[model samples]
Target chain A: MVPAPLPQQLADLSDLVGRMCTHAAGSLQSATAALLECRERLALQVIAREPELDALRVETEELARDALLFHQPVAGDLRSVVSTLRSAGDIDRMNRLALHVAEAVQRRHPAPTLPPEVRDDFAEMGRVAVALAVKAADVVRSRNVVRAIELDHDDDAMDVLHRRMFEVLMDPHWPHGVATAVDVTLLARYYERFADHAVAVARETVYAVTGEEPDAIPI
Target chain B: MVPAPLPQQLADLSDLVGRMCTHAAGSLQSATAALLECRERLALQVIAREPELDALRVETEELARDALLFHQPVAGDLRSVVSTLRSAGDIDRMNRLALHVAEAVQRRHPAPTLPPEVRDDFAEMGRVAVALAVKAADVVRSRNVVRAIELDHDDDAMDVLHRRMFEVLMDPHWPHGVATAVDVTLLARYYERFADHAVAVARETVYAVTGEEPDAIPI
Candidate 1:
């Protein structure tokens, strides 16, 4: 049996994933803005739009299966297909978390801002998420190894900010039993985890480019 | 180009995944027993054994890549690898969580057993985790379709037990504060998520046997 070339199949799958990632990137940025800017309508949109991400997941997986079965392409082609299939789900999950943050923002009834320290972290996390998504989208098309690695820095920045945010909320100095503290904890977690998935995408890119899992992100 | 027989590569990769899964099952069961029985000594063993699981993951992925590149396997092989990759991570994460439980147990002064209400849930979860691991192992060796599909039930049972445990713990009457509540929440999450990974393995089995993802897992 002759095997079909895999580059075309993988390219098609990558293209689709890239577009959906764009949607995901857009959704998260919008969701974060809605939260910080007090746009209830936008937050509602983010909450309602989660299904789109799920849909992309199902569709991407199906397409990848079809490609894998049809081509049975060896080597880099197979790696790309498998990686895209798996990474799509991870991206969708992160998108949903961003929407969840937007929902929480809605419930807070638009006080117009997060507490000063917390808001700074949220803003930083949101920035990192958007940049990470853009870099992820970029790498699939170019497979630029160094560019792929850059996304990890964005994730690192988010982690630094998230840790600072968590520290303040969890501090013993903070009055015990504040409801806001709990909210802050969950919020920081959402953003921090969003960064984590972004880091995962960066890892996948390294796998795609180098044919090896790079060492754990630099300290 | 003459390709290797598709079935041969598929069988080989699937078989490798199944064996590692079986080993993981036994180790995880022991890991849980180590925790619940206050066997910190065993816990250390569990912690020490993680490298094996990681090795299994790397091996499974390499095999999956081989199947894809060499034979251009059809739907079933592709799905198996996809599912195996996902499940392998799940298994590793569960191992990590079990290690976490062990560490907590070691640090704990042993004031009391886990609450009676949740103790049953924990025990049942542990039992089912072991059972699922065993069944998944069997699926690997024999490629039994029935056992593969039934993997869903093991996962469902874990989820129900976990949710019930949380509901009980969260009741104001349970007398837990922020710290205690966080502990229970994290523990419950660990088990719930472990079952989820097991269910994922079953889903792969179904995909392998039937070449289709399960439409629904019976409650």
Candidate 2:
């Protein structure tokens, strides 16, 4: 088969990145829900789906390399190709965060990881994470710098939720046992870091578009 | 100035990567000591040194691209050049982890982050992190696949230490409050991730030499 035109190649690359983001976001949402709701089947499904994200990352990187080597595209074209690689790395980390959530759920099995006291906090964090993931995917698809900047606001909410969870953990009258405290800390971090990666993708997306880091405060 | 020979250029690239690894390892070691010892000055020093590591990564990437474009290296040479880029990413992450450690220490200054009970554990974890960073730098310098594989053992010990720290966190009648628990969890994770990044560098080094992954288990 003949090689596709440069625009077609770029389009294919963009499409692949979008798909990867979709997979990563879906897996993260499902995994977080599994942890909160104790859905073993969904948790297992999330675990099984990790390799797909890994494959997408590899495919995107290879395509980016081939585009660079063959086309030797310069300026914006070069930035787009490089951004594909950088974005793939960010997406892959998001996927890994999703897998960790799944594994946390799997480790706890029938018992829910979040106890009743902190359950609402984790639920809110999960909602924020899912929202960020969805927005991150959109940013990858559209490269809308403004929308990418908006993700920072969403990520801020995640941070607030994370801190609230810590408040409950550190309360003098905290009821949960140490095991539960450990679980909560890890669970909160998973959501917080998931949001952080989304913001990272957005930052890189902005960089790709404007060829400079967006004005969003550095993480 | 005259351009260097192709082999000389490759050697220079390797030398630069080795230096990055050294700086990354040194920064990690200093940061961990500063954290365990509650040395604000050293922590500040670690934080200040971060930009140098970031600059090194950018320089390494530029050199790799220049080598790829100018020399058109192929086969093992090409693999080595590509590995430089990949290894640099891993090393850069290790440096970031160090920065996080320093920042943690700085964040909790005037009072030790680790309480008396878990201080020893954190100290040991810090030692393991430093050892792994040193070994990682050596692997980058020598491209010795055997030594690279050995780094896995160091990582395994880090994992064990992390688990032991969790055991203390989960124990009933734990004395420390929730904030300390949070600090311990974050501290353990920082060390664990630092080790993981070292293993990633080792894996990339092994791949650079053998064109295939070694028998070491994936992180």
Candidate 3:
């Protein structure tokens, strides 16, 4: 049997990456729901899915390696393979970050990980994070440089939410004790990092298509 | 002009990666000092050096790409170049994590970022982080699987210090307000992640040499 052409393999790699991003988004969404609603089942589901995401990442990377070895692709094709390899790593980290959020919920099961005062803030942060992941999947699937560039601007909302969480945590009137403060701070960081990885996926897509760094491109 | 052979190019790649790890170790040490002493000059120096580290990572990645293109090495040589590319990214992130620590110092300068109670803990954490980076440099330089595997155990000390910071923050008699707690939490995370990147570098070296994941190798 003949091997698939290099372009076909590259396309398959992109499809796998897009699926990984979608899975990551679902994980974050479920983890956030668990955090807000104290749903241990949802949190556990996210945790259980981590191994599957890891397997996907390994598979994507191997496909990339084989393409390089068998096809010895040059120029744009080489860039796409390299970018796919890096983007798989980013998407894998996104799932890991989501798993961290789920673990936070598990640690505080039956008790809300998010405090009442900042529940709305966390809810907003979660929405923004899920949106970024969804957009990242689109960018990976379509290789739309314009949409990829938009992810940077889209990430501003996550940043604002991150800073807002810190402000709420540091308020003089904060009633929650140090333990809760620590949880909130770490949880906020996880969501912020999840968004950052989504942005990184977008940047990798942009570079694969344009041979230019996302920031260097005139938007 | 005669281009260097594949073996020589691979050796140069290893040397470049070793330097990157060493540079990362130095950055963390300087940043830690800045945090401990509230030394704005040291913090500024770390910040200034970020571009140089960034440049080094780019050069390392380009060299890896060029080697793949020109030599088209197979088997272990190909693995070495790919691992070098990944290790350069891990080292780059190590430098970025160190920069975050420096920025934290800069933000809280003239006012110590660490409270008196947790000052010693931060100092110890810094030491462990630097030691891990230095060891990682040696492991990358040598490609000794045994030494690479040892980094995981070395990281246990960092984890202990990280948990210790939280214990201090959560102590009922804790005097510092939420602001200091936030700063300390983020700083601890930065150091922990820096150590994680060091461990990752070691793991990559192990994979390049053994064609096996580090964890799968029986000690």
Candidate 4:
């Protein structure tokens, strides 16, 4: 059977990327629930699903390579394929970061990785990260440069939350020992990086559609 | 003027990636010095040089795109260009992770980020990361599948160092407290990620040369 047209292939690439982003978001949500509630089963589920996202990334990249090989697409089409290739990597990284969160939950086992004082902060971080991933999926599907650029602002919220986590760790009256502090520090970094990858996906989408850097574009 | 032949252009791409890896290693070396010595000037210098690596990444990618556009390379040539494109990104991230180490130094300014107890551990980590980056640069330049495959084992050293940092942090008698523990955790992550990117560059090199995933290759 003749392969779909280049445009159809490109659209399929976008859909694949969107699915990866959504999957990453779901994994992160589950991982966060595991962290906050001390649920090893949920964390284990998130960990088990990691290879699924890795497979999706490999499939997306193979599709992109084939698109480049067969279509020899130029200009916008070339940009779309290249952008999808890069975005798949970013989305896969988001999944890996979520896996790290899940692994943290497993490492702590019956004990919660997050202290009671900072549970709300981590819950908020997890919420914001999932939102960014979901919005990043929308941006990939829509290629709406406006919404894509808005992801940068959305990531600012994540940065603020990351800083708050640090503040809690640094408080002089803090009771959690160095071990919990290390856990919180690494967990915060994972969520921050997850949001960063989501923003990276949006940036790739913006670049794919406009051939302009997302930062240079007027929001 | 006539453009270089496709083979020549591919060689140029390899050279460009090699330079990026070398530059990244230098930045990490300086950043590590800054972190261990509390040398704000060195940290600032590393910070100032970030745009240089960023520009190099853009130039490498543009060259890769032009090769694809004009030459329309097939098979191995196509893989070479694609692998270089991905490796450029990994090397750029190596530079960014180095910059994070520098920024941590600047944040802690007058006070050294590493406490005396873990100072040697971080210094060792810094050394291992720089060695990995330097070896990765060699791998990019040589495309020696054997040497490229060696980088994974090299990264195992980095992994050991990373775990050691956590051990120091988790020690019961640790006196650095949460604030310093937070700094150490992030700084350790930066070094670990820098080494990971170096290994990723090697994996790309292995794939480019052998058309086989690095892990799948018999080492």
Q: Rate the local accuracy (lDDT) of all candidates.
A: 0.68, 0.80, 0.89, 0.89
lDDT of 1 by residue, A143-188 (tens): 7778777777667788788768756765665544444554566667
True contacts kept of 3: 0.48
- Top lDDT: which candidate number? 4
Q: Score the docking of each candidate (DockQ).
A: 0.34, 0.46, 0.69, 0.78
lDDT of 2 by residue, A31-125 (tens): 97888789989999999987888777777866776676567666567667766766777788788888988998898888887788987787788
lDDT of 1 by residue, B81-191 (tens): 667666555566556666666565555535332545566677777787777777776776576778777777656777778768656754656653444444455566666
> Can you write out model 3's per-residue Cα lDDT over A1-219, one digit (the tens) per residue?
465899899999999999999999999999999999999999999999888887888888778888888888887888888888778878888898899999999998888888899899989999999999999999999999899999999999999999988889888989988889988999999999999999999998998998885546765
Query: How is the predicted docking of candidate 2 categorized under the CAPRI scheme?
Result: acceptable
Local accuracy of candidate 4 as per-residue lDDT tens digits, B29-73: 999999889899999999999888878888888888888888888
TM-score of 4: 0.97
Candidate 3 lDDT over B12-109, as tens digits, reads 89999999999999999999999999999999999999878877777787778778877877778888888887788789889999999999989878
Best by DockQ: 4
TM-score of 2: 0.90
Stretches of candidate 3 exceeding 4 Å from the true structure:
B1-3
Q: Estimate each model's TM-score.
A: 0.79, 0.90, 0.97, 0.97
